[model samples]
Target: MDSLIFALNAVMPIVVMVAIGYAIKRAGFMNDTVTRAVNKMVFRFFLPAMLFLNIYEISDLADIQFGYIIYGAVATILMFLISLPLVILYTKHQDRRGPLLQSTFRSNNALIGVPLAEALCGSAGVVAAALLSAIVIPLYNVLAVISLSLFSGNGGRPNVKKMLMDILKNPLIQSIALALAILGVRVLFVKMDISFRLSDMTILFKVLRYLSNLATPMALLALGAQFEFSAIKELRREIIFGTAARTVVWPLISLGIAYFFFRDTFTAAQFAVLISIFATPVAVSSVPMTQEMGGDVGLAGQLVVWSTLISSLSIFFSCFILRLVGIFG
Candidate 1:
């Protein structure tokens, strides 16, 4: 009962926020243009600020467990590799293939996962999820660019050079890189016995905190506002497959492996990180990427909506079961 309540406490707020957003949209307070603008702001400014601050605030980088980091990266790549052939077999339409392949692995790690981690395991889990984000976000974007480009239906090959450029230009990746660079410099300052740090800039730090705080709520609202329910009949088959692959198959495989093999090795907080990575919904960004890359944008949107709705239950069960097994006390 305790674990059940704990899981509900963590998951319900997210569901409620999304529901509120959907309600606001239904009431005509927001429209397509507003939703797009909100999304762009969250992606370009708010989310990056949040990530940078989370990483920069970590007192000791050396204390972080690299094993989980490596596992996350490896697991992500494996998902991509395993998903490619499966998605190919599932769909012959090149445009559909790209979004479907992406749905299998890419998660809403930044907006949903970070906050969910904080909810599950407090500050420690947030740091774990943030660190994982530094690696996973870049990998997600790189693979997305490649997958979408490969199946773009352009009849020409993917432009490797452009893909590389896009990855470098990604704002999330850029923020993470900057945070790491600053962290390295802070280490050097420590060696020299310097006392000053970025956090000493009180006004700037507070401003950043404000921006960081806006990321999750505003992103959720935009996601809800953009959610549509009209295409279900037309895309039922693809939606069912993509949603199951994202919310069910991937989480069961990834979390099950972590539980059976690495349970004693990783802390409950670490397990929270795993749940955040694998059990979250498909990324809201996938919709835009699919559109930009000439994939079936409708399918991508539907997958995001359906997976998010289902992941509420999936994540709750994950937390409840893990807690029951003594992963959390």
Candidate 2:
């Protein structure tokens, strides 16, 4: 009950905000053009700012949990490889393949993971999720770029060089890379006993803070505006498969394996980090990425809606069960 309440407390505000967006759209305040512009801005600017701030704010390099970072990064890659074959086997619909493949492994970690982790383990869990994001979020963007490009199915073939360029040019990936580099420099400064701090740059940090604050809510509102209940029936098969992979199958396999095999090895907060990565919903970024990269935008949006709706229960059950088994202790 406690875990369930905590999960709800953490998740319901996002849900309600989404609902409000839906209501505004239904009332004709927003149109497709407006939604598209907002999504593009969110994708190109706000999301990247959010990713950068989260990664840059980590206190110290030596304080980071490299074991958890390696585990999380490796797990993300393995899941992408594993999902490629599974999605290929599941459907040959060119449109379905790309979105479904991405929905399987690319999570809403940037928006959803941190708060959920904090709910589960307070500040410790938040720290773990942040460090986890330093690795996992960039991996997600790279995989998203690759997956959408390969299965794009516009004609004869995708341009490999262009796809590679897209991956490198992705704002989110650029943000993560920049943040990592700066953090490394900061660490070196610490080693040399040089005075360096983010606070030294006040205006830039404030701008990033404002942009970061805009990212999640704008994305959620845009998601709400763009979501179509009618699209559910249109992409029922893809939606079901993607949502199930995100909200059920992955969590059970990953968390269950950790529970039985490495139970004593992970700290409680590390376990929470794992759950945040595994149990979170399909990303809102996928919808925009699909649009930008020429994939099934409708199916991608449907996947986000269903995945987000169902993931609340998935996360609750994961925490409940893990707590019951003493993982949260």
lDDT top scorer: 2
Off by more than 4 A, model 1:
112-127, 285-298
Each prediction's Cα RMSD?
A: 2.9, 1.7
User: lDDT tens digits, residues 117-160, model 2?
Assistant: 88778998888888888888888999999898878776426688
Q: How many residue pairs clash in each candidate?
A: 0, 0
Off by over 4 Å in 2: 154-159
**Candidate 1 lDDT by residue in tens digits, 274-312:** 888898888877765665567887788778777877887
TM-score of each: 0.85, 0.95
CA lDDT, every prediction?
Answer: 0.80, 0.85
Candidate 1: C-alpha RMSD after superposition: 2.9
Residue pairs clashing, model 2: none
Question: 85 in model 1: Cα distance from truth in Å?
Answer: 2.5
